[model samples]
Target: MTLDAALPALSSLLGDRLCRSKSELDHHGQSESHFPPTPPEAVAYPETTEEVAALVKICANHGVPVIGWGAGTSLEGHALAVQGGIVVDFARMDRIIAVNAEDMDVRVQPGITREALNEALRATGLFFPVDPGANASIGGMASTRASGTTAVRYGTMRDNVMGLEVVLADGRVIRTGTRARKSSSGYDLTGLFVGAEGTLGLITELTLKLRGQPSAISAAVCAFGEMDRAVAAVIETIQSGVPMARIEFVDAATARAVNAYSGADFPEKPHLLVEFHGSEIGVGEDAEIFRAIAEDNGAEGFEWARQTEDRTRLWKMRHEAYRAILASRPGARAIVTDVCVPISALAQAVSETQADIEASPVEAPILGHVGDGNFHAILLIDPDDTAEVHAAETLSARMAQRALRLGGTVTGEHGIGMGKLGYMAAEHGEGWQVMGSIKAALDPGNIMNPGKLVPPNNGAVG
Candidate 1:
């Protein structure tokens, strides 16, 4: 009936793998963004799905909260155990079970990271394209339904994930979907748990669709005289059917952070980092068309990367932009918030967000996958300054409200972890209540990652 009552049994089942040391608790408690550390009572490392099922059973019997932990790269306190319980760390379960290259799909343990999976697929001529900038575990990415720079072209994890093997709260294991490309099966249960944030169940394995390596690849960065022009160019390019593999936007503040942290000389102006993936001739044509569009939009400081090394460096810089922004203000924590609006309204959303940051007390760097009309603002704040934290929180709330007003979701890729839970009722309305009902049906005790995604006490809106 309690976490302490379940710990002894977990220790016996996992041996030393059930960690209760102060250091382990402290490590598992920390979050990437601005959340107070609230560690779990214990951490369990399960190597197999059978073990995960068993551990879940043990926790279920005692009504102990079971929080799934992946690579710990989540931004919204997704892995932190807000309520005292046992955190099932998946690091030991990171193994590629099977790679069906001919079918262009891979069956992998939830613990395997996107980077590691892509590295293993390098010789296979196929790769997993859902890169969320972080070397996050595939399980964690699926849990968040994550998307990133390449999502503009390849689509998000929601599209890439085909099937899942989930361990429900009561310890029963069930498989959803099939390896086949399309299905008219009973229900899309795979989709349900993909972004459920470990509320309904724990994902033990995933079957993901893959893409072949492109014959040609090219990346470029162009500076825009104005932010609106940069955003306008993105809308026009997407509307023109450019088939861009990636198109990212970074404002002047983010550009400065990149220059300072990565030692790259970028003009402190709104910039677009674009990439094209297709046949050699097709990519060339696309690049030329993109160039014309950029020129029409008054883009300058053109830098093209045709070589593999050059492209790698270009993306490395973009991927490291977040870290660079964090380094921009030493000792400051970021309250990173993202919102997706309709493409037509992106310019207004970005413009107003920029104005909000300009008027705010904290420094917030802006960057995102603008190709999909999704962007993030890294609101940096002095943790010790309550006023600064409050200001950042207010700005984040404003951003969410603006997105909803503009016909977009409060979050584009980031799931409804503890950070964005407040907006679910506003965004989903009565549908949010339906979600709580589903949660209650699946985990009646609310022992599965309680205080996240769904309402507390299973069915209540709260």
Candidate 2:
């Protein structure tokens, strides 16, 4: 029942694949966000599904917790070993099993990153559309049910992931869903596991739906005099059904940060960075319509990037926004808050949040996939300043409350890891209990990523 007791069997099972090095443990323990390091006792690398199953079985038999580790890009401490356990690092299991170009889906091992998958599909004239901007592993993206800018059009991981191969807590292997587009055969186990955050099982493989590369792509940047006007443009564009491929919003503060960091001279004003993907004529019409909507909402400095390199540079800035925001304040740590409200409530949410940030003691930059009513505020605070941390926390709590009040989710993309556990009860109410019941039934030993998502059980295993 002890981690030390389980080490011998794991060591024998994995040979050199079992790692107890301090550097490895430290690497697996930390997160992209501000969660303190809680490294696992050991890390295991399994190159095959059978190896993964066997590794899980040994850990289960010894009553040792097993946590899955992907690209270590999770902001909510989703992959960290909160309690001492063995982290099943999937770095070695990265292989693209098959590419069904006709069916428009690809089979890949858990460790394949979204970027890598897209790179592999480049020659096939198709690509995976779920871009979380982190180069995150496919399994990690599926586990968190991630969405990003492109989600406004191509959909999130929940819609793009067609099936999964999972290894349960007890080391039993099972497959959910199939290559078929839709299913009505039985319970949707795939959906259940997508956002489970590895509490129930570890995803070993994923069959993800793909989209054909668009014939034409056009991106633009439009600045607004006011934050409300920028949000108004987003709402109007969405309501107008312009079929935007990506529509992201960043506040004046964020725009300045990105401008300084990326060497792009953008006006210090609220801006919407948007793109359209379709036939050339269709994209032209969409761009025209979106321009009208933007201008109607007081948008100025409308800049278009129709060339490939220009569009890439535009998105590169958007993706590097977190780093840019961090650079704005040296030595300041961030408490990133994600909240998604109804599309109709988008303007009010952003306006109220901006007002709150203005009154707060910290500098919090706002940005997100506004087309989907999802946004994030990077609440910056000096790590040594207690008052600053408290103020940032208060602002984050307010944002979560506001999202719930507006009939939205506390997290639109980042899944509930240890960070947002407090809001689950309020967000889901009694339904949170049902989630616990499901976790208990499937993971009776509670070895799979304990201390996350579901209600806590005081570290009890089995």
Candidate 1 regions exceeding 4 Å error are 460-462
The TM-scores of all predictions, comma-separated, are 0.98, 0.99
Residues forming the 10-long window of minimal summed lDDT in candidate 1: 453-462
> Could you give candidate 1's per-residue lDDT for residues 206-320 as a string of tens digits?
9999999999999999999899999999999999999999999999999999999999999999999999999999999999999999999999989999999999999999999
Regions of model 2 farther than 4 Å from truth: 458-462
lDDT of 2 by residue, 1-462 (tens): 788887777788899999999999998888888888888999999998888888888888888888998899898989888878899999998999999999999999999988988998999999999988888999999999999989999999999988999999888999999999887999999999998999999999999999999999999998999999999999999998899999999999999999999998999999999999999999999999999999999999999999999999999999999999999998887899999999999988999999999998889999999999999999989888899999999999999999999999999999999999999999999999899989988888889999999999733455
10 residues in a row with least lDDT, candidate 2: 453-462
Question: At residue 164, what lDDT does model 2 achieve?
Answer: 92
Supply the TM-score for candidate 1.
Answer: 0.98
The 0-to-1 C-alpha lDDT of every candidate, in the order given, reads: 0.92, 0.92
